[model samples]
Target: MIGQRRHFQVAHRPRNDDESILPLINIVFLLLIFFMVAGQLSAVDPFEVEPVESAVDGQPGPDEFMVIVGTEGRLAVNQDETDLEGMARLVAEHLQRHGDAARVRVKADGRAEAVEVVGILERLREAGVERIDLLTVPET
Candidate 1:
């Protein structure tokens, strides 16, 4: 009796299989909805570009000519690829044709540098474009 040894053991609870994954499912659905709603709803430009968004209600005029600036600063006037000088010449000719009703819409890539955009704007202004509208997507 004096040399007897005692052993001790600790009890552990088994994990329950009754845990529900409803919360996980809910999170997945919420993410799906967020993506669908937050995603871009605007029309794709001729070249791959993500334009800036605006809160204004008015849309770009249909009669106005469009000038697209690529991400790398490539210029396209009325869907015709050209340099800045060429674009200026073309826009000037168009302005003469439309007379006082001439309108120009500039759509530049969001990733384009500010300098590039400014240069394009300056060219348009030099071509006698009194008012140049910047194109943007509506903010949701």
Candidate 2:
């Protein structure tokens, strides 16, 4: 048989481009989803408001309501921009909704006036916010 006219043929299957790249595509999609979900974990401020420096570092609770105050007197509650009265109204509404268990945190720009910040705290107090925590960056 070897010396005679015996033909040996190897069967080869065509490669599918899509099948070769399936794992890569899956990994890309997984990475995309991971970043999308991770990006929304933290609340973003509406404007530029650098936190003041503090001697201690602290982490905010997930359920805490955030109030951002910019250097130009801009105010935002939970990333929604509002005026002082509007902020006060929102705080009151939040207090009514969450009652005494509501947690409030204020993140103010380092350059913001102390009087303005104090006034905001006073307004919050009037709005029935019993405890307010000020967010700050730890000194390096």
* TM-score versus the correct structure, for each prediction: 0.63, 0.80
Tens digit of per-residue lDDT, candidate 2, span 14-59: 9888899999999999999999999999876789888999999899
Top lDDT: which candidate number? Answer: 2
What's the CA error at residue 52 for candidate 1, in Å? 0.7
User: Compared with the true structure, what per-residue lDDT tens digits does model 1 show for residues 89-116?
Assistant: 8898888899877889988888889799
Best by TM-score: 2
Whole-model lDDT for model 1 versus the true structure?
A: 0.80
- Lowest summed lDDT window (length 10), candidate 1: 40-49
Write down the lDDT of every candidate, Cα atoms only: 0.80, 0.89
Residue-level lDDT for 97 in candidate 2: 92
